[model samples]
Target: MSEPAMSEVVANLNLVRERIAEAAVRSGRAPDAVRLVLVTKTVEPSRILEAVRAGQADLGENKVQEGGRKADALAGEPVRWSMIGHLQSNKVKDVLRFADEVQSLDRRSLATALDKRLQSVGRGLDVLVQVNTSGEASKFGLTPEDVPAFLKDLAAFETLRPKGFMTLATFTPDETEVRRCFRLLRDIRDRARQDAPQGDTLTDLSMGMSGDYQWAIEEGATVVRVGQAVFGPRPLPDSHYWPGAAGTA
Candidate 1:
């Protein structure tokens, strides 16, 4: 499987957490405010269990089938699975079965599908409305201007609890552009919160990946989706992480 040893995973996790703490303090916020959702897109269940036992309980997978399989394999483990990929309507039931949160609630069709299924089950799911803050054709999310109204629309879905926003910054090495994208999502969140309903719903900013997470934390990201640094590198390209880029992938 080529994954790291359990001890290596623990050391990697500690390094990541230490960096997170440093970033949070540098940004004038407590490290506890930021939660890390370790991305395990292709990571094996046994390796994932190693991390869970090491005290990193929240895990994120970029595909429904993969996450469901891991959830089955890691059954009875103290892990919380988050559906962090572009979820189609047909996969709603499976995701609801395996995921504790949906981080890519970017479109109304998906929301309608989720709301319908959750209503049938009489259950609720915490969701983060995704924003394509980078304006890339290869990402899935509402536009910056469209997010406030979308957050307002979420109120209609009684079973879908809107917790905050998630986004993919531009896949570039340009620090300025990358940080700009993070800053924009923060601005959108702030503006959305001016409305009482959205204000109550918007509390988290789930932006940044392994490379850009520190900048995201500096700009008020409450949840950072990290993978490569904690689990070694993956074969996928940075663009592959965007839900909208799956067709070409």
Candidate 2:
């Protein structure tokens, strides 16, 4: 696939931003309240830089090595990097080098790895606990039932700040199924707040993708990972971007 034109990236960004605004307004929330994190997996560094120069503040990359390369290429640019795919303990070092946040923090072991790495550098990281709202075996996240206890356990990792929850709604055309998955994440967040060390900190919901961001906004998503709508469809197979074939934004 051709790299997205600079003009195309800018134009698509405008359209996506407008859609986000309309979605937020329909949900009775200010447009700025919802944050857009452009998922840039498989996009080359130059084109990714194009989007960054076009005013995209947050960018999500699925792989640590790829993110690190982009981070190196775009060093000094004003962009926040996020690891939005399944994280491994071994990759924590590379991930910490670039990611401002880890949106797929699902396991205690991974949390421990991240905390240890951050402590070495004397920096703290913002993270969202990933929840398998769709109940799919292929997805990587804490089960909804396990989330409350998990949030409580996060207090042990001082370098890790719990920002909220992230989830990938079921990849289907049915809006009901998609919205249900999103609402479940919100509901779980609501219930887990009482068990959290700081309830106010769990203020963001990282749900939604290119296909169903509006539904996610209506269901209370403060963070949306968008890709195809902004960068155009990725040319590779699902496994190419998301190992194990997890759905992309």
Backbone clashes, each candidate: 0, 0
lDDT of 2 by residue, 87-114 (tens): 8899999999899999999999999999
Worst 10 residues of 1 by lDDT: 240-249
Deviation (Å) of 65 in candidate 2: 0.4
* TM values, all candidates: 0.93, 0.95
C-alpha lDDT values of all predictions: 0.85, 0.89
Error of 2 at 170 (Å): 0.6
lDDT of 1 by residue, 17-120 (tens): 99999999999998777999998877888877778988998999888888899999999988898998888899999999989899999888899999999999
| Candidate achieving the largest lDDT | 2
lDDT of model number 2: 0.89
Candidate 2 lowest-lDDT run of ten: 239-248
